[model samples]
Target: MRIGILGTGNMADALATHWARAGHQVVVGGRDLAKARRLADRIGHRTGAGDLRTAAEHAEVALLAVPFGAAAALAGTLRDALAGRTLIDCTNPVGPGFRLLTAHGPSAAEQVAAAAPEALVVKAFNLCHENVWRMDPPVFDGRPLAVPLCTDHPAALALASHLTRDLGCTPLAAGPLGNAALLEATAALFITLWVGQHADAQAVAPPLSHAAGPA
Candidate 1:
């Protein structure tokens, strides 16, 4: 797959590196050409680099790895270029105090979909830190990381699932885009617990076998 990354940030670097290493064609684009070039070069594997529109137009699957504030605007700007494409959103709208910034409105994923109405938008990969994504396989004590994706489009979910597997993680169908706010809100709560409270956010939930208790 030809993967275009819409940001030259940590998420872009981490995910794109894995994809490129997994034999996917990756083109990284950012507002700054030089930064994009540098990242693309670092990702190597003949990765391409250009401005944001170049990336969007060059992809069958585009990763919207931009900051939460910039995602909707960029998607809106590239609406025509993104038509018939699959867009994977990995951004979290957690603002200061670990607040879900889109609490009163649509979730960030929905906003992107509204911006690029013709594109297949999927919300995924927002739960983990970029550092965790950089962990090569992100398995813990033998269990590979599970990436939950929310999207109504089948093609978009397939692409997101493929990418998740490329990182040696499992893909979980997490319902449609309407449920994205739940994922976003969960991120906020986890962030608050993990960073602010210096607690183990993962420890808050029991394993699947214990979810219903005394399994």
Candidate 2:
């Protein structure tokens, strides 16, 4: 996969490095060329670096790792470059109190899609910390990390699934793009439980078999 990462932040660093290590061609792009170059250097493995548009045009699959507040505008501006490409939206719209910033509006993924109407947008990778993504395989308790994806495009879903498996994680089809708000809201709740309440967010649910009461 030729992966373009549109940010120079922790999530970009964490996930891009893994894909690059897995033999995928990676280009890191940011508003600041120097930051993008620095991130590329850190990712190593002959990773590419450039300004945002350059990276956008170089990708078969693009990861929108930019801040949630800036993503829609950036996507709108890069609409032409992103057309026909599979766009993975990993941003969480959580405010200072771990609040769901989108509230009753469209989810962040939907906003990005609306901004870049021609892009095949997929919502994924927003459920975990950057450090968890940095893990070599992210397996825990004998189970591989399961990544839930929401996308209306089949090709976009496949691309996202491939990337998830590249990190040795399972990709689950959560639903189409319409359900993205649910995923974003879930992220907010999990963050609140994990950080604000200092609780194990994973413990909030029972295993699959026990989800609807005893079998």
Best prediction by lDDT: 2
Q: Itemize residue pairs with steric clashes in candidate 2.
A: none
Q: Evaluate residue 93 in candidate 1 and report its C-alpha lDDT on the 0 to 100 scale.
A: 95
Model 1 steric clash pairs: none
lDDT of 2 by residue, 7-68 (tens): 99999999999999999999999999999999999999999999999999999999999999
Lowest lDDT sum, 10 consecutive residues, model 1, at 206-215
lDDT of 1 by residue, 2-71 (tens): 9999999999999999999999989999999999999999999999999999999999999999999999
- All models: lDDT? 0.95, 0.96
Strongest candidate by TM-score: 2
Clash count of each predicted structure:
0, 0
Given candidate 1, what's the lDDT at residue 57? 91
Query: Each model's TM-score?
Result: 0.97, 0.98
